[model samples]
Target: MTTPLEGLATIVGPGNMLTDPTDMAPYLIEERGLYRSSAQAVVRPGSTAEVAAVVQICAEAKIAMVPQGGRTGLCGGAVPAGLDRAIVIATERMDRIRVLDPVDFTMTVEAGCVLASLQAAADEAGCLFPLSLAAEGSCRIGGNIATNAGGTNVLRYGSTRDLVLGLEIVLPDGRVWNGLKSLRKDNTGYALNQLFIGSEGTLGIVTAAVLKLYPRPTERQTALIGLPDSQAALTLLGQARRASGDAVTACELMSRLALDLAVRHIPGLRDPLGTPSPWVLLLELSSSRPGGLREALESVLSQALEDGTAQDAVLAESGTQRQALWRLRESIPEAQKHEGGSIKHDISVSTSRVPELIERASAAVADALPGARPVAFGHIGDGNIHFNVSQPEGADKNAFLDEWPRLNRVVHDIVMGMGGSISAEHGIGRLKAAELARIKPDLDIELMRRIKTAFDPDGLMNPGAVLIP
Candidate 1:
């Protein structure tokens, strides 16, 4: 007698399917290590047709399926939830760049293509694919689209949802929906590609995508400015945008604590400013045209300082220095892990209200757990902040982690009060599903459920992910 997964193996070929637990370990673990997934096997389908065949086998058996891409998501969206049997449909074997049309300014790529590779392909074509993130080298385009990922560049270029033109998805009942059109102005009917873009794999599996491209920036300027506080940082962002003619490509914020942790943990990474302030803004300006970017950025900083919005600043004179400055910004998460356990919130508010959200949330967390250090940092230009709290010195890791729920509520309530989103950039995977239900309007959630039902009536696509059953 053979197992049900053995049928799936026949479709993907024996070499592409893994039944041994050791062989499947990598696919079964979430990036944060907060959740461990249990699956009957991990299937690697090589193409859209192969993916459809595998889905058909699983659907016939009524076995749940989780669509995985690179598995670098912080939300645990790709990890299987329950003890019930399931299989992970890994897209690694489907990695390919199917089309690159510089004339149309678009690239059609398989879902498993790594983000960094896609950017490189666009660069080679004298274009730019601007959806960047810390996990670009490991995260796949499919996952980025699934979560509607936003990064530093979101202030200018927008999120993955904005970058995508169309997508190819395998439906719940093994039907393939190829909506991969590269046209920019298609208004024929309902924009169906969007339905799966941020659905977190609950609706269907994204197999490929047609992504929009942009003219590559030829001139660039980066600066690190020290601010009195988050309020000052917000003000400086306005100044930078106005002074630079709205050419600011990135504006990231970091608390003094966040900077200190990065400096201590990451070697060769040092604070560019001689003296530290309560908050710092890592601002970058870019243009396709050459010259004057440095001068424009300098003028912005001069005005910010003269107006008392900035206390001190350091403009990167060389590419090496600019990279060093970015390293300090990107290394905060790894640094926090080294310090102790951390409770994190990826929340976003209106740009004007960021200061209040940070100030009140920090005070609230500190009052609840004395000595808890808040490391607030991220894309301030777009109002998404990675507000994280490190454990107090000498506290038990597990004990500190157990306070995740209480701490989350303290932060989320303040976010909701400010008309902000609790899960910004990161999708509401299993972690935030309950919080989403509690906070979201009943009618809004009901509409979402109806859409989910229409797409996946059997609910086999990534069960127990974004929606609670």
Candidate 2:
């Protein structure tokens, strides 16, 4: 019987196969250093043809194939698990910008195209691809679509799924399903791309995609507003939307604890407003029409302050200053890493339930584990909050981690009770597969399993992810 490594080389060529464990070290582990699995080999396929060939070889050999993108994924989606003989199908080498149509306002790019490069290509053509994330500089568009990434701009532009016009998927059985369509409207059959948007590489591998584009904003306004709490932030978001109409692009909320960590840990970063408040709301408005955006933001902010909803606020006077204000908001996640080990809960509820969700989750966590610090923050405009808990001061790291499962149960229970999702923006990779199985309705699980079996009956694509055995 031929070895899995040798079988992969036969399809993708020996040059693309890495069998030595030392050279495969990086691909064996995940970004967060949480889960590690040994791969028999790592294959760097250069084209969709190569990917299909590799998949066919693996399926014939009864070996598992893990589809990997930029490796910046927070979930263990790209990470291998279980004792199955596996090979990672790395897509980085397939990077290419296939087509850019300024007239039709669309761009067709390969799965491995870096997210930042795609954004730059759109901007050069005087269009905007607004799926902005801090990891955009390193993350690939394939992983973004696979995870259905949600970032700050989601308030105005929606998630990656919203911007995707079409996709090219490689099925588990090594069949290349070329479903790439760039049209704006297609009243055809069911939208197949939607199935793979947040599938986490469970059903198929995304090889290329057709992405939508929008008119580039000519005028922009940004503000740093001080509010008393989450309740005030919600009120401010409503007021800003009322004032700016459709130009309200971003409304991000940051807690005082979040800001403190940014200042204490991250260098060259300070409060944007120069004064500390319990909470801050970063607001932005963009328009195709030039001028008056700053005035419009100021007018809305003035009303907030008069209503005692805002203590103070500042507007960016220039492009450089605008980026500076954004830098503070973007630095929160990185700055948080320096603090210590943390338990993260990316969840969302109805827009009206923001304040209640924060209050209930915080109280429950504190009650469950005494002295656990809540570092809750994120896109309040979209009803998603990263409800994180910092370990108690000087506590045993492993001991704190030991409580993770129970802690997750407490938090997730409250989330479900309130009619909220356990996993919001981030896809459920290996981390939450079991929890997902336990909590989701049986019919839902049965349907998902049926679909998985239909597309991947042999189960060659990212097995042990998004499903329980």
Candidate 3:
């Protein structure tokens, strides 16, 4: 008499199946404390075949399945929810770079390979894999593709969706769809691979991907510019892009409050500018063709400074200085944690309307939640601003957090009005499922539901994710 658990264990090997509460604890937890759920067991599948086998048994047994990757996802997409007796298909053991075709400029990697390891592999092969984010160290490639992650490099290289040439997905029915071809153009029908990229595992589990790589950057320039506002940041971004022949890699906008929070909390970080400014722009440019990048960047900054578009600027003269400037931009989120109960809204409008979005959102937050510190910052070049609102000084943390839903309504209303996405980079996990349903038109919601039902007829694949049941 073989139990379903015993069958899954047999498929992945007994050592890979974790049923002990202590061993399964980490897998059951969500990145944000917002979601927490239990699983029958966590099965570490080591290959696409193994993943398929596990899914088959679970499907036959009518056990719900949750596909979990690195578990570094901020949204609860990877977390098991809305079901009891569900089995967690963990991908960590499946990590292996299947192929590194530097000549072809594509790397076929398993879904479980850590993002940083892939970057290093690409760099060693004399190429660049530019899908970078703060969680690159621990986040896995599978989850990145699953979320269609947009990171710092999206300004230039585009999102994970753009970097992916192909994907191999485990369909909801325990079948493996091997679409891992490296070809740049294959108009062979519905583009099935793309359907799973940003589906957040509701459609299928991403098993592996053929990732696009670029020529390694030979020259780079990093600078921190003190700007009067986000509008100035946008102006400087356009000028720098034109001057550098669109070599601009990252254009991050940080508010005074966001930077101040970083400087105040994170040690050894100070404002790089000589004078205090209301906003700061962290601009970076990288190119395969070496030598003239700095001069081009300097020329743009020179003009901006002369015209008063930029108040003041500090260009990183060395690698160490570059790290320092980046540290300021990257550390803002961590610093916000020190300040109590920060509500984050990862929203985006058109690049041209970012300033107006910030202004309108800030005003809305102020009116809705008086004394809330709206830390507006992020990739202004791509129009994704992380409009995070910190709690009022001395306000109760839990109470302020209780206001998250209210504040979301306030901020998201304005964003929707301006034709912006409520969840830009972060997909519609459990966090925004209801909100998505609320705002999305009935027809749009119907289509999404149709897709979910068509793929996951049993509602077994990552239930209660992107589409609410």
Candidate 4:
């Protein structure tokens, strides 16, 4: 009798199937190292047909499957839940750029293509694939689509769902649905692609996609502005947008603590101001046509400073300067790691209510656990903030992490009260599954469950991700 592992080997050959603990170590650990995944084997399928075959074998043998790509997800969505009869289907081997149509402004790429590679390909073709994140260098496109990722550019180019035109997915029962059309406007009945875009592989396995592209920006301006508070930062954001005629591409907010962490941990990164303020905004504006963008940005910052909305500001004068500023913004999460245990929240509220949300949430957490550090920052242009809380200095790491549930309630309660989403860019993987159920309306949860049942009745596709079984 052929075992399931041997059967999977037959589909992708022996070298592609990894059963050794050492060989599978990389796949078993989540990005944040918060969870340990267990799998019978890690199978790498080089093509869609091979993926289908592997899925078919797993389905027939009643083995649960965990679909993974690059394994850089912060939410533990790609990690398995230590199931005895589960296997990980990694898409790293399926990387390929099938097509790049500059005329059509679309690129057809396999799921495993690294996001940074896609951006380079777009740049080479005089186009821009604007879905970018800190982990773009290692994160795969499949995972981006699975989570409907929102990055700094989401303020200009929408989230991953908006950039994607179509997707090619392998269903739970080994059926392939090739809806890989590059059309912009398709009025055909029900839009099935939307279902799997942010499903976190619960509905099906994403193999490839048709992504929308835009014209490359010929000119850009970046500014790091210090504000008195979140409200002042919000006011400065409005000033930037109005001054630049709404050409602002990114507006990120960083608390003083977040900036301090970056400066302390990341070498060569200095505070942009002589005296740090309570809050800072990283503002960027771009234009395909090169004409007075810097001057316009300077004018906005000048007026903001005079009006008391901005305390201090520095605009990037060169490409190197712009990248350096961005590095400071991107290094917040990594720097937090050196500060001991951290509790992260990716929540979003209305644009106007962002200031209040930050204030209330920070106060609530401080009251709950005295001396806890609040490092709130992220894409304020779209109202999404990474409201992360660092453990108090000298506290036990495990004990701080153990308070995750209690902290989640305190933060999520305020988010729900303000009509904000609990999980903004990060999908509801195993981390927030219970919180999702607790906060969401019963009817909404029932609808999601019904949809999951319709697509994966056996619940064989990513059993414990997104929707709880």
Residue 439's lDDT in candidate 2: 85
Q: Each candidate's root-mean-square deviation in Å?
A: 1.1, 1.4, 0.9, 0.9
Clashing pairs in 1: none
> Which residue segments of model 3 deviate by more than 4 Å?
none
Model 2 residue 73 CA deviation (Å) reads 1.1
Going through the candidates in the order shown, the clash numbers are 0, 0, 0, 0
- What TM-score do all the candidates reach, one by one? 0.98, 0.97, 0.99, 0.99
User: Model 2, stretches more than 4 Å misplaced?
Assistant: 1-4
**Positional deviation of 445 in candidate 4, in angstroms?**
0.9
- Ten consecutive residues with minimal summed lDDT in candidate 4? 233-242
lDDT (CA) for every model shown?
0.91, 0.86, 0.91, 0.92
TM-score of decoy 3: 0.99
Q: At residue 243, what lDDT does model 3 achieve?
A: 90
Compared with the true structure, the alpha-carbon lDDT of candidate 4 equals: 0.92
lDDT of 4 at 436: 90
lDDT of 4 by residue, 84-195 (tens): 7799999999889999999999999999999999999999999999999999999999999999999999998999999999999999999999999998999999999999
